[model samples]
Target: MRYNIIHRTTYKYESPVTVGHYMARLEPRTLPFQECPWHELTIFPSPIERAERSDYFGNTNVYFEIEGSHQKLEVIARSLVEVIRAQPFDPASTPPWETIRDSCRSDVYNPATPAGELTFASTLIPVGVPYADYARPSFLPGRPILQGVCDLNRRIHRDFVFDPKATDAATPVEKVLKQRRGVCQDFAQVMIACLRSLGLPARYVSGYLETVPPPGVVKLVGADASHAWVSVYCGEVCGWMDADPTNDVLPSERHITVAWGRDFADVSPLRGVTTGAGEQRLKVAVDVLPDKD
Candidate 1:
């Protein structure tokens, strides 16, 4: 499947900002099952400096600075990408969950290591007794890693509620766990914490999801928004597998990968520091359309 994606972020500040530096990770990833041929970014008030680089997890990063005073800021990112569904892995064929978890603790850690770096706790995702207990029910002894994780994913979707107003980005994971409600980011982070508490390697993924309206209903422009999911490393051959607990499905063709890292703080699409600003309102609009012809 091919897609033309548009993402726009607008900031309306009551007080003008004199200087600002911002970074964005809005480019679609080029992976074995996906290809991004074109990408463009437009920022208003034109930055005084701009640079592009890659992060530790290989996500494209763009940095720009605005020197002059500005009350409003607008950024537009456009991309063209192609994605194909990879063949599904047989869950029963995968090694047991315990086996995969143990390999991540090997004494020698390197690029070739089995996801040792991701097995530990991060700033946003904390591994605790509660997390392990919350996930243990799904991971029975000798169960296939993928199958076990899928059960955990289903349980999250079944138990929690998708309430946009329930939490914000800065809301604690414990709060989300207790409230049992939040957006995709909350679910993904909660899952990551659970997996890490179980000594497994899991990462946070940020991207876009194709939202199909009801039959015969026209899709609203800008109705789509950014989405998040969790990726678990299931041993060597079965590498990173993505699961969306919010949707209770393994992400595939309909999910467009943007960036990934230990947690949402690491791969946030747009974040930075600004000087001389008070009271700001943020607005984001996203559109993921299937390419025709």
Candidate 2:
């Protein structure tokens, strides 16, 4: 499946004063099952300086700086991507959850393991007893890791309430678990916490989820929004399989991956420090349209 995605972010500030620098992680990645051959970023009040670089996790990150006074800021990104389902994986055939867990905790001398780096707590998610407790029900003794993770995914989908107003980016996982409410980001983080607390390797995924309208119905422009999901390392055979606890589905052609990391802080689409604009209002509009060609 192929798609054309447009993401627009607009910021209107209360007052204008000076300089601003921003970083964006809006480019989709090309992996064995996904390909991102073309993408672009457009910024209003064109920046005085800009550069692109790959971060520690290998995600494409672009930075730009605006030198004078500006009361408003606007950034837009466009991407064309193709997603293909990978080889079939058998959850029951995967190694027991404990095996992969141990591999992830191996020695520092071991060849750098991406899964290992994600097994512990990070900037936003912290390993804790509560997280383990929440995950224990699905992880039975010697259970195949993927099988157990599927159960955990469904449980999260069934348990939480999606409320955008309930929490912000800064909201902690502990609070979301307590309130049982949050957006996709909250669910993804909570799931990561649960996996890590159980000594398993899991990462947060940020991207776009295609929203289909009813048959013959017109699709609304800018109706889609950025999405977050979870990816668990189910041993070496399964590698990373994407799961969307928020929507209770495994990511497939409808899900387009951008960047991933230990938590949202690592892959936020846009973030930066500005010398001006004391207070600001942010509006984000996203459209993920199927490309006819």
Candidate 3:
């Protein structure tokens, strides 16, 4: 399947005086099952200096600086991508969850291997007794890793409510766990915390998910929004598998990959700093449309 994605962000400052610098991780990734042939980032009141590079996690990042003062700033990213659905596999066929945990524990530390690095705590995700206890039920002794992960994913979906206003980027994982309500970001972080607490490698993924309308209903432009999910390291043979606890299913063609890291802080879609600014109003609109050509 082919898709055209548009993400637009605008910030209006009550008082603008000086410089601004920003970093964007909005480019779609190219994976074995995904291809991005075109992409472009447009900034209003073009920056004085801009550069592109790959981050520690191999994600494409764009950095730009604006020296002139302005009351409004707009950043838009457009891309065309093709995604192939992964073939389904039996979760029971995966190795035991304990074995994978042990392997991560015993393996030598290697930054080149993200799976090992991801097994420990990160900025937003914490590993503690509470998280391990919460995840222990699904990962009983000798349970297949993927099977246990899937069960945990389903349990989260069944237990939590998707409330957009319940949490913010700074909200701790412990709070989300206690409240049992949040948007996709909260669910993904909570799941990551659970897996990492048990010595499992799980990364936070940021991207877009196609939202289909009801039968015979026309899709609304800008109705789609950014999405977050988790990717588990299932072992050498099976490799990384994406799971959407927010939707309770394995990601497929409908899920477009953007960037991933230990947690959302590492791969936030957009982050920046301003030299002088007062109250700010921000607006974001996203569209993920099927492409025909």
Candidate 4:
């Protein structure tokens, strides 16, 4: 499947006087099952300095600074990407949850390896007995790691309500667990916290999930939104696999992966520090349309 994604972010400040610096992680990643042929970032009130680099997790990151001031700031990211469905596998065939958990816990201090790096708690998600207990039902003794993950994913989808008003980006996972409501970010983080609490390796994936309109209804231009999911390492042979608790499905061709890390902070689409800009209003519009031709 091919897609044309446009992500637009606007910030309107009550007062703007000086400079602004920002970093954006909006480019889609190129994985074995994904390829981004073209991507571009357009910033209004053109930045004085701009550069691109790869972050530690290998996501494409852009940095820019605006020397002069403006009350309104706009940054638009556009990309064309192709994604293929990942090969299907039997979750029950994978290693037991205990085996993977033990292997990761033994050498978790070594952040050099990707799996090891994610096995511990991070800024947003915490590991604790509560999270582990929440996950225990799905991870019975000798249960396959992927099997348990899929069960956990399904449980979250069934248990929680997707209420945007219930939580924000800074909402804690523990709170979300108690409230049983939040957007995709909360669901993904809660799952990560649950897995990490059990000494399992899991990472947060930030990306786009295609949304389809009703059969007779026209698709709105900016109806889609940024999405988040979870990926678990099921030992070496099976490698890392993705699960979307928000939708109760494994990520596939419709999922466009951007960047992933231990949590959302590491791969926020756009983040910046502004001088002299107080009382800001943020508006984000995202479009994930199927590419023609």
Each model's C-alpha lDDT?
0.93, 0.91, 0.92, 0.92
List model 2 lDDT by residue over 1-293, tens digit each. Answer: 99999999999989894888899999999999899989999999899999999998889999999888898999999999999987657779988998888787777544326678788899999999999999999999999988898898899999999999999999999999999999999999999999999888899999999999999999999899999999998865667888899998888889999999989999999998988788899999999999999
Identify the runs in model 4 with alpha carbons over 4 angstroms from their true place.
107-114
- Candidate 2 residue spans exceeding 4 A from truth: 108-112
Best by TM-score: 1
lDDT of 1 at 160: 96
lDDT of 1 by residue, 210-288 (tens): 9999999999999999999999998778789999999999988999999999999899999989997899999999999
lDDT of 4: 0.92
TM-score of every candidate relative to the true structure: 0.98, 0.96, 0.97, 0.97
Off by over 4 Å in 1: 108-114
What is the per-residue lDDT of model 4 for residues 1-293, given as tens digits with 9 covering 90 to 100?
99999999999999984899999999999999999999989999999999999999999999999987699999999999999976867998998999887776675553325577688899999999999999999999999999999999999999999999999888999999999999999999999999998889899999999998889999988889999999999888878899999999999899999999999999999999989988999999999999999
Q: Which run of 10 residues does model 1 get worst, by summed lDDT? A: 105-114
For model 1, state the Cα shift of residue 194 in Å.
0.6
**Model 4 clash pairs?**
none
Instruction: In model 4, state the lDDT of residue 69.
Output: 69
TM-score of 1: 0.98
Ranking by TM-score: 1, 3, 4, 2
Clashes of each: 0, 0, 0, 0
